[model samples]
Target: MAPVSALSRLPTGAKLFITLSIALLLLALIAIGATLQTGRLADSEVRARLRIAANESARNIAIELSGDINALRVAVAALRGDPADAPSCARAQGVFAQQATIGTRFSIVDRSGRLLCGVPLDTRIPDDRDDPVDVRILNHRGLIVTVAAPGGAPIARVVFPTAFLARLVGSGSRAMPLGTALIDEDHSLELTSIPGQGPLERTETVQTDLGLGGLQLRTSIRSAPITSPFLVALLLPLLMWAAAAGLSWFIVDRLLIRPLRLLRASVAAYTPGEVIDPGKLGPLPAQEIRELGDTFRAISRTVALHEAGLADAVVRQTKLTREVHHRVKNNLQVISSLINFHARGAPSADATAAYASIQRRVDALAVVHRNHFAEMEENRGLNLRSVIGELASNIRATAPEGAGSLHIALDVDPFLVNQDVAVAVAFLVTETIELAMTCDPAAQIRVAVKPGDEEKRAKLRVVSRAFVESETLTHLLSTRYGRVMEGLSRQLRTPLHHDPMTGAYEIAFPVMGRD
Candidate 1:
């Protein structure tokens, strides 16, 4: 069987119905059990009452029989000194004349069981005393009480008719639902209120002591079942169950089910991204449902306000970004112009070349700044080949008088880097070209960029056909220019390699992606 706790899975209405049903069922069972128990108690009470009635009847009979025996003893005492002859017997009969009745005779028997004297005498009785009994109940006749005379005269027997015992038990009353019998010690039925009413269902018996021995008065009562009475009593519990069920349904519907249904309907109709009106749900008697509706309305209002604020912030941030990039582009153009003017005013060839190189580096910055503003939305830094092409053009534009034929060839892979790192790379290329011009001034320069050992790193190679190999140039690279390039390499977090045999200058560095 499933565990009882699975009942919790039932709906609210079903749970209420089942709970009330179980409670009523138990109450009905208890009522039936108690009613059956009461029936048993009633049966017991009837048995006790019947036994008491039989005992009382036997006691009354004993009292009356005792009185009769006393009267016979008195008569025998009166004849104590008289002779046991004809006149004596006649006198004895005259003495007991007042006590003669039907089923009760004043008879005197001698020591040999002979009838000595009698009132209304009949000679049919034999002079035999073969069997003796103290209290003898005769079949359909009477109750017999035999006793010996007080002075050892013949035995005197008092016979009380069956009508007397019937009167003692009140057999005619409707309250007495019993059949009564007077029985001997051997359980032989001598006299009964109902002579042939089959066997009794329930019997109670009491033993009574007469002068000779004892007799049993057995009374039996029929069974009185509780089924009919229990059925009659069940109407009250049925009515109780009806009342409880009605009240429970009323309370559950009013306080719980109806309100919950309303709440569910309101929730299903709700739309997201919109403020909900608390008034839509109106009111509910249940406190928790009312509070839940209030909470939902508050949440919708808060979300709407937060979304409005976020939109405003995005608009302000975009405007500020465009203004900053515009100012930066204008400033870079002015700096490039100033560097060109300074180069034209130089007095010597070496000083003019130096100024032109500085102007080229400035122009590289201006080109990068323009590209940055153009692709700001892409945010992928600067394209490596585009920056290199801008740097090569700037170098060719600033070439000295006869060196205008100097050509820079480019073979570069596509990649991206942030503004700062791209500028650092341009400066490194500018320095390599200046170093090539210092060695042969007329050599062609080749610059190329490609993927490095890992995806996030890239190598830039600058090769030149310069054979000058000036010792002073080596000294400048080691002492002065070495520090600037090494510092740039440290900022880019990569090492720079210089190969004099191939005139190959290479730097490998981690590239930062913008998107």
Candidate 2:
């Protein structure tokens, strides 16, 4: 016999292994392909854009504020008194207009840092009145530059619109592809092109002096997944597939394939006639295969035990049957001998004939019993061939004197029947031969037992040429003797039929063990 490999025994291990291997490989390929094709981060371009935008806006603001301070100095020099009392600070107003600036609010303040004219009286100016140009942010007002007189002390402050800063910051076309934010030195947002609530991937920041003393302009270029649909679509399922395949392989190997291998090993070690100790197998993984192993191990142990005891049980049963048949034969022999002794003391010829007939029937039963023990060692059941052959001899021995020795011939087939049914068949054949004998003392009876109809039934025929006219046998068959033969036929579940022309009595019945 060829040795079985451990892998071959696992019902689905190979298929599952191949399937998982292919799946994981495919997922890896997809991830690799997507990674190779995917675009890289926009950090370099974003940093440059941010730096340029911040620098350009800062430079523009510084130049404009410097120019505004020089112009405001001329206005301060042209005035002789507080501009708050002047109907028109006409010269300063004209200079502001000449700058062609929009959304500019101007205020004149004294050396004391009190707002004097040209703007809201409630406006408070910064205390740094000595500087030529000082940029400051007031609470309600947005961005302002404070300018002192070019020759002296009186100062003028100009506040610019938020749009002015926006135009300068957003001046470059590619400044921020996704978005940009301008943060003040105070960490407050000065301007933004997109919201800041989402997760942000920020590039290198750009900081440039706004010519506003310590206040600097900081620009950061940032983006989010919401800004890139292609990246999201390309990478999401790839990551998911990789994760799923990894998790699936781990679970299938641990819970399914590993346990399957263990089960295969356990089963391969099993031998048919030897009981397997369930304890020899260790705890299996928690899976359906574990339940299957437990069931098979239990069944194998139970079947092995049954196989071990079966031979002994057969020997004991056969011995008991042989012993029972032996005692039955002895008892039948005793009965046959008693009938013979009575035959000798019969008072008349008719009484002697009656005792002899009784003796013949007892002898027939004794022959059946004898055959059962004779074939006991080969004990399956009675072989009909051997049993019928023996009965022909017994019938010839018990024939009455002066009737010339009975000549019986058999044409029998090889078949087996159990003890009880074999006895019935034996008796039926005996009674048949006896009836033929009574019909003709000089008769040669031919008994045939052969397979019929696919071996499911057996046909038995008793024919005698001596009873050609059928006068005596026909009369005997219509009498009480016929009823006894009929009863035997019914017990065998087969009916007897005689053909008048051939002088053959035929019966067909089912045989046990023929199948």
Candidate 3:
């Protein structure tokens, strides 16, 4: 046989606990995974917003520079139409002044790098004018644009201060602080100061080219802080998972487990012929459990009622049977009295002997009836020992004058049998003893009842010297007595064995109380 496992031996409550715990653990893991995924998405969104800000800033700066370059082209056209003199420079400066905005200035410079008009800038002009317009950044301080004439000679130049680029980048919002800078990669200079304050906890940076002489726009944002409320949000599902597990377990234990346990205990304590009370279980939580208890209680009540009915029927039957036996016994006694009265007035000895024989057979039946009635109350069958003993005595007492010294020895074992069996045994024993007495008046009869070869069966033996085959005994058995004993033996459902050698008549009888 296989050994029982520890987990299998555990009660329902313990198993439920383990199952709920595993469910909680799985839920916790899923909740944690969701929280982490949410964080990643949030980070991606922050980086996307930063990239958008950088691209926007770069676009705005390019638009501003394009407008200034267009104005520089006008100044260059004015300078190209006249000689390289003070008057022409004056007119070009006048054209430049009309297009200039705050923190911006322009100058017309010759091919030799001579300042002809307007504000002078400490910057070199590229001699190679293959490009019509040239844009430059100077130490992150200002943006310089130079436009060449038709002969590929420098004509005009414009300088916009770094402060002008700062206004274009704009300021950061209170929720998500941003830092913006215009960086000149070639010169390694930051044209605009970053806008924001304090050390950035989580920062995302995006750089976009401004398309003006290696100038690039850098945008950085400080992500929102991870507050207590945010952390609470992340753990909310886990908290809910735990709460749900606890609530579910409580519901199961209260509604299912606990009620079932109580019901089982009540059933275990129930006795036969008793009803199980549903009231002992108190109030149940779920409807199903309540219905189960009600069903069991109803079945118990039904069984108890059935047992009560059967008991009443058995009692009534016993009383009726005993009354019948009592009446039969009275009738037999009356018959015996009538026979005795007739025997006293008999004209011959044989006539009186025939009356005695008839009286003895009637007495045997009466003895069987009396024993059967006595055993009816106990429901156990009649005891052959008592029935046969009383029967033998009655026979000896009512013996004829010829058999006045009749000696009958009883060696019967105590065994029970039904009424039919008792009646047959009584009649057979009476017949055998009388036959032996009639054949030989001084015959010694020994009646023995012993256990048979089979279970719940007994062998009844009547041993006597008179039972041996003889002319006198044969003459007596040739009468109705032989057929009467054969009928009694057939009623017992076994053949009567006559042992000529031992002079014993034996027959097997069924015993009672096999159950």
lDDT of each: 0.69, 0.68, 0.80
Candidate 3: pairs in clash: none
Q: Report the C-alpha displacement of residue 412, candidate 2, in angstroms.
A: 1.1
Q: Which stretches of candidate 1 lie above 4 Å from their native place?
A: 1-307, 467-473, 513-515
Name the best candidate (by TM-score): 3
Model 3 C-alpha lDDT per residue in residues 394-447, reported as the tens digit of each score: 998988877887999998888989989999999999999988998889899999
| Residue 147 accuracy (lDDT) in model 2 | 69
Decreasing lDDT order of the candidates: 3, 1, 2
Error of 3 at 200 (Å): 20
lDDT tens string, model 2, 1-515? 23346546655645565566677768766765665454344445555666776677677666776677776766666542545545447656776674436566787767775666567434566464566666666552466667667554577778766666566556344524323333344434354454444563434556776656666666655532334565555666666765666677678777877776767786788777765554465666675776787688788878888877897798888889778877777888888888889889999988887887787777767766776777667667777888788777767777877567678888888777777777778778878777777777878899998887656678888898754656787788788468888888888788888787788878887776641
Q: TM-score order of candidates, best first?
A: 3, 2, 1
The C-alpha TM-scores of every prediction are 0.48, 0.51, 0.56
